[model samples]
Target chain A: MGQRIQSLRAGALDVAPILLGVVPFGLIYGVAATEAGLGSLSAFLMSSIVFAGAAQLVIVDLLAQNAAWPVILVTALVINLRMAMYGASLAPHFAHWSPWWKRVGAYLVTDQAFAVSIIRYEKPMAELPKRWYYFGAAVALWLVWQCSTMTGIALGATIPASWELDFAVPLTFMALLVPSIKDRNSMLAALGAGVAAALTSTMIFKLGIITSALIGVLVGYFAEGSER
Target chain B: MIASQSTGVWLLLGAVGVGTYLIRYSFIGILGRAEVSERVQRLLRYVPPAALAALVVPGLLFRGDNPGLTIHNYRLLAGLLAATVAWKTRSILATIATGMSALWLLQWLF
Candidate 1:
């Protein structure tokens, strides 16, 4: 129990800083969802159910635009494809766990949680403690996300339209995308994808974003391969 | 305004929820010990910047419902400023602040 507490405390403490960034993003999502014509109940529930910030934002925007359901689903799924990679990366570390525990752990996985837990797990550590730490970090983030999103939803109704809260959606994405462009390959990938999305913005069913993303990934892959 | 809660919206949300969970659970629950190839991992690394860029680019360039690119589009200019801040500070809060403030200022002036 003492060991569990220690690990849990460590996980929560480590995740605290990341929550600083998440809180604003969550709030923005709540506001955006409300502004985009999603019901308050739906806005709040989507945050709990979807729990993927970027995808949730996209869904709300697409819904507002009256995009078809398949378009919304495909776009969201494509945006979230990275989570599958995250699951794979964390698999080896969690291989020894029971199926039930693994299921619960998988639900807890988020970009921030994975980011913190992986760094902690990389160091030599026993399976049990590492798992406990993962839970700690994941749970902390989960709580912050839910609370901040709720706060945003509650405040959403009061926020005037003139505030242009909708712009927060793209601004948040900019904040997220800019830092990840650290190298030549990633830079070229972003440039390729961004231009594709802009040029194809008129495409039916919002295929532009997905196509752009695929092109970016392919470009980045070949660029990296050629370098090697 | 409570957007009309359509059965379609609920179904779409349900599908997204289930699909996202399955994606998250994929390797962790079922493929625990399976090794991913190096090529796939490299591709996954690019997903973040690429996907986010695709999402943001159109929003920055296009104003209102139209897809035209105009110099007077404050979002474009403000978004550029925000990107510069993000590049410099690597901070989410800073980026949002810079972008929103620039947007408001531009709107007021223009």
Candidate 2:
């Protein structure tokens, strides 16, 4: 029990900094959702239910444009496809967990939680206490996200359009993406997807994002293979 | 104000919620200890950069109103500046501060 508490505290502490960056994002999502004409209840529910920042934002964007349900669903799914990879990467660490524990853990999985937990899990002595650490980080992020979204919803139109809060979305992505471009294959992946998305930006129903992501992943995969 | 929810919006939200949960549960629940194939692993490694790049580039390069690349696109300039800060500092807070400030400054000056 002591060990569990210790791990949990460590997880929360580790993720505190990342949470600072995410607070503005959650707040922006709330403001954007309202501006997109989402029902306040629905906006709140989406945040609680989906709990995936980028996908939730995309849903609001598409819905506001009156995009079809199928298109919106597919676009959100494509944006979230990265979660499967995160799940796979973390599977080894979580293999021995009970079914109930795994379900809860999976629900709490976010990019921030996954990033912090994986680093802890990869350490040499990370066998038993890792789950608690994961929970700690996940729960911290969950609480912050929920509160910040509510704050944004409450503030609503008061945040002034002049602030251009919309830019926060791309800025957040750029911050996340730049750090991940460490190797040549990763760089190529980003470049390829970026160019594809730019070229296809005018495509109907926003299928361009899905296409560019697919092309980028394939390009990166082949690049990795060639290097070996 | 609570906007009336549409059936299509409800459907989209429901499907997204289910799909996202399943994606998160994929390997954690069903696959358990089984090792993922090397081929699949390699592909998964690129998911982050690919997906993020796809999301970011369009917003930076193409504003919805203007709908094309232009020298006056402050977002593109700010995003590039932020990317540089991200690479150099590797700090999320720093990147956001620099990007947002750069954007605000450019908007003011230009």
Candidate 3:
């Protein structure tokens, strides 16, 4: 227990870059939430309650458009499917953790937290402290996201939409995706998903986006398994 | 339809929060005893990249409600090109500059 706490403290020191990386994007999401018709408190509360940036952005946008409740619900579900994947990936590293601790960690799951935690987990198991490593990473990410998002909301109504900085959202996604495309199967999955999304846009309305994503992921998973 | 500042918006926000929590809770709660199948575990690996691309591609390629292939819609084309360059170069700065510049110049021209 002492070792885990100490490691968590040490891990906190290493999360500086992760916090920095998330700040601009969290700011952007805050700006978008306000623009999507959420008031300052609503924006603040959404960030805190959901604690998931992309899902919150989409939900706010959907609300702005007065989308149906079911549609909004499904969209949030599809966008957050990756969190389940993150949970599964971290299972082995966290297998020894108490159920209560694991539940808390699951609640704190975000892309930055997952990345840092997985990296720390994959290290030499004998030397690394998985419990504190995750605690430090998750806490650091959660705090930075909440702080930067609040900062964006505070600067709201004054920040010019002309900065046209929203484009960075997709750019950031591109940065994330490129690094993972190290093989044919992965490439196929991406291409399939993109094409499927494009085609789905033609019929059955917005559900196509989620459908395409789900299909592409399934294809990639099966392809990888077959090859193995 | 609720106005942006209306009480309805607050209600909508609350609903969204509840829904988001439900989705997260499902996986973490239900899967407690049941291990993820190997197949499901393998599939989860591809969800991030594929899903993100699915989100971005339509926004780039289509405008308002129209989906078309045309030289006039160079923002879409430029975005794809920029993504390709980023794929090859792995330069976030370059990719954004190239993609946004393409959109800016094209908007100016046409």
Top DockQ model: 1
User: Per-residue alpha-carbon lDDT of model 2 for A122-170, expressed as tens digits?
Assistant: 6774555788889999999999999999888887768787887777777
Per residue, candidate 1 scores C-alpha lDDT tens digits across A1-228 of 999999999999999988999999989988887787787787888876788988998898777666767888988988888899989989998899999989888988898999998898889999889999999999999899999989998888889998987888899999999978989999989988998998888888778888899999888889998997
Question: What do the candidate models score in CA lDDT, each in turn?
Answer: 0.87, 0.84, 0.70
Cα lDDT for residue B2, candidate 3: 43
DockQ of each: 0.73, 0.64, 0.45
Q: Give the alpha carbon lDDT tens digit for every residue of A5-119 in model 3.
A: 8888867877766576578667767776666667788788778677887777666555655666566667776777777777766766666667777667777877777777777
Q: What does the lDDT read for residue B37 in candidate 1?
A: 80
Query: Using Cα atoms with residue i matched to residue i, what is each candidate's TM-score against the true structure?
Result: 0.96, 0.92, 0.82
Error of 2 at A65 (Å): 3.7
Name the weakest run of 10 consecutive residues (lDDT summed) in model 1 chain A. Answer: A60-69
Model 2 chain A: worst 10 consecutive residues (lDDT sum): A120-129
Write model 3 residue lDDT over B1-110, tens digit each, in one string.
34354676566656656655554544555465457787776776787778777767776766353345666566577677788878887765666667778766766777
Where does model 1 exceed 4 Å of error? Answer: B1-3, B65-68
Error of 2 at A33 (Å): 1.5
TM-score, chain A only, candidate 3, equals 0.84
Model 2 over residues B12-104: C-alpha lDDT tens digits? Answer: 688889999999999999989788798888887888899889888987887556436777888888888998998898776787788889989
Worst 10 residues of 1 chain B by lDDT: B62-71
Question: What DockQ would you assign to candidate 2?
Answer: 0.64
> Per TM-score, what order, best first?
1, 2, 3
